[model samples]
Target: MTEPGQGQEPERAGSRAERLRNWWRPEGTWRRGIVLAVLAVLLGIVMLLHSRIPNDVGNLGSLLETFLPWFGLCLPLLLIAAVLRRSATALIALVLPVFAWVSLFAGQITDKAGAGGNLTVISHNVDADNPDPAGTSRDIVASGADVVALEELTSAALPKYRDGLAKAYPYHTVQGTVGLWSKHPMSDPQPVDIKLGWTRAMRAVVTYHGQPFAVYVAHLPSVRVKLDAGFTANQRDASAKALGETIAADPAKKVFLLGDLNGTMNDRSLAPVTSQMRSAQGAAGDGFGFSWPASFPMARIDHIMVKGVEPVKAWVLQPTGSDHRPVAASVKL
Candidate 1:
């Protein structure tokens, strides 16, 4: 005879196997989490066809694209819910979004930075209301950039930055609110009209290695999201269009655009500009080079884009007194 409980072991094991099978049956797994499955599929479709989303209504498409990367967060939440619901359908549906997200951004997540470049450039939207413009200038100097472009310079803070960066960057020009400071010589500085009735953009030719390249500095109109108005970016959008036309008409073989665009590269409204140039951060940075809200950068409103130049590396500099973080890049001139 067997031990008292030994005979019942086979029966218990059989019962466990039956229960597992029942949990996976169509009635148990497929019937549940249908909502979650649909949501996952919809997310996949949205990310894959983000460009097709119409922007005419409330600039909804542009708004969604601006923070597109953040949508990845939903995947994990969906996964947890699927597991709790014991839904095989939802688990399988998650693959669609996972694949879509990876296809769109996997390359960006990888380390693409390489070792060397001929010129180092930096850009910042030094807040107009910064408490310490002098200190912010010092922080920029420490970066050892060959070229520096600054935006949002207020009349009150101008003297401080000028006094602070004068020694290191002897060649500098201030046109309206935008400025460019360079170790090398700069000339033909003028304000660019972005149809704002005021100067918020400027351009200069900087001579590096005895060759000149056009450098544009612009501070596009700020955007806002109001309960009734939706994404208030009409001014910014119009400015971007005008700026693109100006850049296209430039005769320089090599060009560099630096400033606070108040929009992302993903934003379709910026296509006129982004289409013609390559983003240094997208090509060379290790990660998302977000440079806004110095305290907690969520997006890369500040940019260093190039035309007819090779980007070697890109990065975000440490925070300063300004509300925006500084962005830097190295490129082959």
Candidate 2:
């Protein structure tokens, strides 16, 4: 019933429509490439602004730092896809995250390789209920720390730590659950009120190698997790702010703080102290160096921070009988 030219024109139009649909449909490789590119761009921005922005998004910082290194895994996957799809643009996008990670940790690399100058320090959260006080003491003493600070000291466990650490640490002071065990004599030891019940944080002046330095040992309140509340980091943040004020008031220029902060250095909640102090591990550690819930460490909650000391080496010790691992660092005053 149709003319020959009219039928041929309809067929041509149908074919053109089919070709357009095929061109617009996204294939598997193309979809993956787009996703990788977007992720890389977002992660790059996060890295770029990490220092400027406070990491104190409740428990968000802790969560991110715990899983941050894992993000690097996506890099390899992206690279493979880029090669297979021949996506030069997508490949370039992957470089953003790599650069961001390097920028965030670049200072640490240089500090670790630098020469040591004069002090050795150790920091640990000796669990209040630890069963092996002697073993904990032995491990710490073996670290050769000129000054040792301990948090979570209990009345029952205090004597045990003292007796075990007596040979190496002659001068020491206990303020509530926090204490300082030093190889040199201590002067002006006093309790610091971090607004936690009783006294769980304290400060002391110790003369190591004839040089005077203000030392602080603190056990910030533990963070909690709940279904309703994702991460309860409020108490820790308040305590950090109070502690920061105390440190800022100190007369000594050279200061050291050691403890189980219950938060990572990357966490913005601890910005009060973190802003002023340099983390020993972040300055000189080899890897992620997590130290928490000793059964499986996903975050570095234990820290050794210095105000006027240079770190030579920093590392986490093997697990004792506590829920957290001890962090040790060799430094120069």
Candidate 3:
């Protein structure tokens, strides 16, 4: 009996030693990667309070908001690191960013496209130096849009577009660098002063099915990112303010604004416009609907915004010769 009890004591001591080893090992899930846990929390805070970030320095807040959707990529990267480090703390902290991102953008991932729309409109920034203006015009015709808006039109290429689109669109108007063409009759066409001293914006009343609505084509001043000046968007911001005022003053109840806004809906600088209008892509699009740098669209600078109209569906078209892809949207009214 004494010999059997001695063997049992040795076995119990061995089990206690194994438990101690596990507590101190690097593989312990709860005790490792405290720094990683802190970083995960910080990431979540930045995403959650993005709107509060100051834009006084480099328009940093607007810039981050422009690419806000891309921030989700960090979650998977941090998740891999947490797993490798065996950090239960970091893994739990990561839930904040995951929840914030999902809450902000999960609806965009699900298809919101529904059928039954009366009008289809297309907007494109045909590059000033496009190598194939005629081909681009042909592509626009193929899109089967009832109304088309083109920006950055050059004097040399304007005739080509006019000729290519003549039969399909007999009623058209051009003001400075932007133009609008519609199958329906257009009246009261005039250039809008966006403080640019040139015709980069225009408004016209288009009669559709005996009902009239105001259609605006604008190419807001472009923004540039400079190392010394940060986001040089003061000029664009001024133009946006002026354009928004003009749109607000219009007596028309239903309005459509199309062309290159040069800023996304998320950018606070464009709030003058975005505050009053609704983005077709955000309301009823299939996906992100990025439309710039045609080869690889990272942001959506071009827009189809509406007031007092219902967006049915929105989508991006196949690439044209221009640097920006065309955007098309259908509306109920």
Error of 1 at 16 (Å): 10
Estimate the Cα RMSD of every predicted model relative to the unseen true structure.
2.7, 6.4, 2.9
Candidate 1: Cα lDDT at 8: 92
- What does candidate 2's lDDT look like per residue over 195-234, in tens digits? 8778989998988767888999998998887676667878
What would you estimate as the lDDT of candidate 3?
Answer: 0.92
- CA lDDT, every prediction? 0.92, 0.80, 0.92
Those runs of model 2 whose alpha carbons end farther than 4 Å from true positions after fitting are 1-32, 49-62, 65-67, 81-89, 106-117
TM-score of each: 0.93, 0.82, 0.92
- Model 1: worst 10 consecutive residues (lDDT sum): 23-32
**Total clashing pairs for each candidate:** 0, 6, 0
* Model 3: per-residue Cα lDDT over 209-272, one tens digit each: 9889999999999988888878878889999999999999999999999989898888989999
The superposed Cα distance between candidate 1 and the true structure at residue 303, in angstroms, equals 0.5
Counting only residues 3 or more apart in sequence or on different chains, how many pairs clash (N, Cα, C under 3 Å) in candidate 1? 0
lDDT of 2: 0.80
